[model samples]
Target: MNTETFINQNWHDANQQYLSAALAVVRGALESYTTSLPHPPELTAQAAARQQAVQQAAAAMPAPSALENLCRLFELSGFERDLLLLCAGMELNGDFARLCAIAQGDAQKAYPTLSLALAALAYPHWDAIAPNAALRRWRLIQVGEAHTLTLSPLRLDERILHYLVGIQYLDERLAGIIEPVPQLGELVPSHAALAQKVTAVWNQTKTTTLPIVQLCGNESSSKRAIASQICQIQKMHLWVMPAQVIPLLPSELDNLIRLWTRETILSKSALIIDCDELDINDAARLNAIAHFIERTNGYIFINSRERMRLPQRLLVSFDIQQPTAKEQSAVWQAALSDIAPQLNGQVKILVEQFNLSPATIHAACAEAAGQLAQSQNNNLTDILWDACRIQARPRLDELAQWIEPVANWEDLVLPETQKQILRDIAAHVRQRSTVYNTWGFAGKSARGLGISALFAGASGTGKTLAAEVLANQLRLDLYRIDLSSVVSKYIGETEKNLRRVFDAAEQGGVILLFDEADALFGKRSEVKDARDRYANIEVSYLLQRMESYPGLALLTTNLKSAIDTAFLRRIRFVVQFPFPDAAQRAEIWRRIFPPNTPIADLDVVKLARLNVAGGNIRNIALNAAFLAADAGEAVQMKHVLRAAQTEYSKLEKPLTEAEIGNWS
Candidate 1:
């Protein structure tokens, strides 16, 4: 049909069949305004006849009025709808008389107002709807802005609050429901397992609108893909909720709800909330979103690494992970089959180099194929290797070193007593699975449950190294926090920064080693002024996060006494590193040289007399090795002595004959 004819027919069909209570609200509004017009009203016999036809169509509807249907579509009803109609009608014609005429005998007593809305629109029965009532939500509908109810352009209907009174809660009906669930070709197996569980719950309940499901892990795409997959299967649109954009004003949230509802109904699509990437650092915003999801009609899949609680709503939870080895192998073969013969050992090695999803692997292979195609060459192995290397491009700069290690607990040089403490912390983390879950500790409190440690020592005494060791032992990544990057001078910025760190690392339990933590975690001073209060606040903030975070957090400092005693009380483990004795320094000097470094015979006992920490010893050893390499000679006692002189000069310490007496 012609566009004009098609459009006319569409509107015609809508008029004949879509005259729901939602429409009645609009009609009532129009009717209220029609009476006040200077022009002759359109309420003749013909208009009456038409209104009767509209009412017949509305009654014939299996649903409520067009107005009520709109409310239902957006999860609003009763007082909220009435409040919306009042504002909407008032908007069409800025007259309170129009609103008063529409509510005619409706027991709302007065017409449209903030006070009236609070008294009648809000009800305790519908906690989910009016969780934030008028008293709590003054910003939603502006009261008497210049002596009149707010008539600002609405983000959502101002009527939902008014229409929600005495309304019964409605369960989402799944039968005959159509939704869009996106096709996420393949993801890591752990995510697949979680998605499978979500599908089962959806099917089991026979519900179209899903309960909140969180995919907690370090893998971002894994959780996102599950949401996409759910959307594809359910025939829904994927709207990744923005971090800072969610409205704090109740009116704006209501408006968003309307917008989403209109889009869902208009397109017959579901919504996939990509909240995993959203700013979870703002507790207010995060909490607001969690609440928003509960009130939406379409299926909602929230992607976050942390366990988020949805106020009063209960969600069927799931955790996502990368695919298993067998799954990864299948993905590699599928993605690289076209060029498998051309790649020799590179394909197998590439698989081990990357920890990625089937989709990511396919993307890598496609990239390789594209690059090879451009080259006009059949050397596919080079392309695959390039792709593999590209995928593993280090996420952090030298600002943090991620050591994939070969050493274990035996490699650490702490004393015997300290070693047991280190092992005990490991034991807590290792057996926490059984103890926390089976022994009822999980239910007690999330506070003070995370594995946190305070490594007290001078610089270069292996505080960072110990963190790396623990991370390697636990099979997790180590994120060495650059204190310069995290400690913010601005208010709320510190929390925002910390939130980003925690949120980003949520996908996996990474060891966050806050080196030189003294800059941020100093003793909480008495609040004599605003700056002092804010400083204490920052420390208290970190303390709360350290207690609640599910991952491992480590703090390193030279002066443990500088830390607040209260803060120290919450930490699970404290490791002290005393200055190494002469014998211990000998061991450090012996091990400082790498296997590849050429070293001439040197008196280990004499080198031990340098009187330096492990850090200094390593620096001296490295400088001496560089000196020897330049001279094309093996590192010997003379090179060590020369390096020690430079090290002492840098430290501003005069070399004493007692220490460096036999240096040369």
Candidate 2:
């Protein structure tokens, strides 16, 4: 039999033996009391024989019973232990009620009570009924309503009763707020090392007081798995509670801490306070968590993305990184054991693209396997790739605007030199892993490994479209960050917002396009006041994050001169998108209309003479098409002239005869 089954069986046998002995003692007490009118020798002899049989059976047991363990763990005295058994007997044995009534000489007081335990059982003490007694302190046995402590109806806690019977489960009252964490089967090397550290620390600490462990990481699943693995090593169950659930009021916090600490000791369990989703800036919530950590005891862990400060207690923090690329490749191969040979070289690409944790990798593979089974011709690599993207998509969507890349290189009308630069950026991104890891460049220097670019040009010069083109070419998601929204007015808030953006985007390695970059990356002013100093700090912070970011960060600015020169020097590429000359404008006009649009006798040469940018030309073509649709006619030179006039009017520029000359 398995060890668990064997141990449980032994416990069961011992519990039965102990219960039999206790029942014999109760029978002896009842019979002796019933024949109290006169000294009956026969009944007295029977009582003495039963008492001796009970003591001999107790001594003859192979091991201490679960009841004995419970009493020892909770430090319950003989009186308190018997009181607990008396309450348990009411539930386990129906005849115990009659025995109790006979012992008490009152039918109404048939149920177990403090008064009856003191009157009938051996070694009964008044202190056992006190508020701080083992019976009341740990809530082992609950007392029901009565005029006094002695008269109150006594009953065993459902959880403790089950424990004595060798049944293990969480208490019903705690079921809603806390959940048992499943032990992890396998861990990545980094996480396994972390788990080992946690185990070592826990073992080295004195049993009376253990330091609170803080698991700091961005991946919640990995943190939880590590915590669970550590608990497994210590032969303890794991439970998780969201940090947000910690009570704010002092009284409620105290009660919760006390109850959880007691439960931890009683059940040999550890707690993981999950603060991954909590807003750490909230003072009240932080205070509540601090209070809980200060007051609680036993094995506890706080899971958060960043380290938390707890002044009242000693804490040890473990920084958990996502599985390394090599580890991830191994995980992918293991997860795809059936198809690993088929995907001989594609596994590396998946690992490079998505920085998924081991658990996520396994889950994604399982999901992909299901999809693969549904269709014979479906590509397993594609399904897995899409699943990884989907897993990494949700967290970042809330922080930035997800732009679907519908525009390819052809859609972006830039200079040939600029186009080549964009391609080089894409190439750098595609081969970064090979160059850094395989070529040993990463070992040389860790700084500026991230691909950052500056798209400096006038407004509407295809900067954003260039980003979309790169995203399409790389097959990666693109997010457009509004600098105004990210750059907070308050101190340090800007860095916090940027940290969130970068951290969320780390997994997918998605391309980040910071639009209107000049708003946040303006030239640093002389430090004349606190505001100017903070502005410089914000700029420096952005530069640091961009340099260290694992993915590409594209910054677009309409005014190139407004950006700091120091910032420009750090960028790997600066693609200047100049205004479209007359020839380029004509080309834009030629391809501006979709094939489906009806057209008639459009003068492209004359339209190009308007001296507008490509964006304005496209706008004129669209306006002319709408005008033709309303007039029920194909777009002609006349419609183009009218739209150009309206566009120039909006810009407050004169519709000069030299520009639109001979259009009609």
User: Candidate 1: where are CA atoms >4 Å away?
Assistant: 1-181, 184-267, 270-403, 406-411
Worst 10 residues of 1 by lDDT: 166-175
TM-score of each: 0.51, 0.90
Task: Write down the worst ten-residue block by lDDT for model 2.
Answer: 27-36
Cα-based lDDT for every prediction: 0.64, 0.84
- Over all chains combined, what TM-score does candidate 1 have? 0.51
* lDDT of candidate 2 over 577-611, digit per residue (tens): 99998888878888888899999988778877888
Candidate 2 accuracy as TM-score = 0.90
Error of 2 at 196 (Å): 2.0
Residue 115 C-alpha lDDT in model 2: 82
Q: CA lDDT of 437 in candidate 1?
A: 58
Model 2 lDDT, full chain set: 0.84
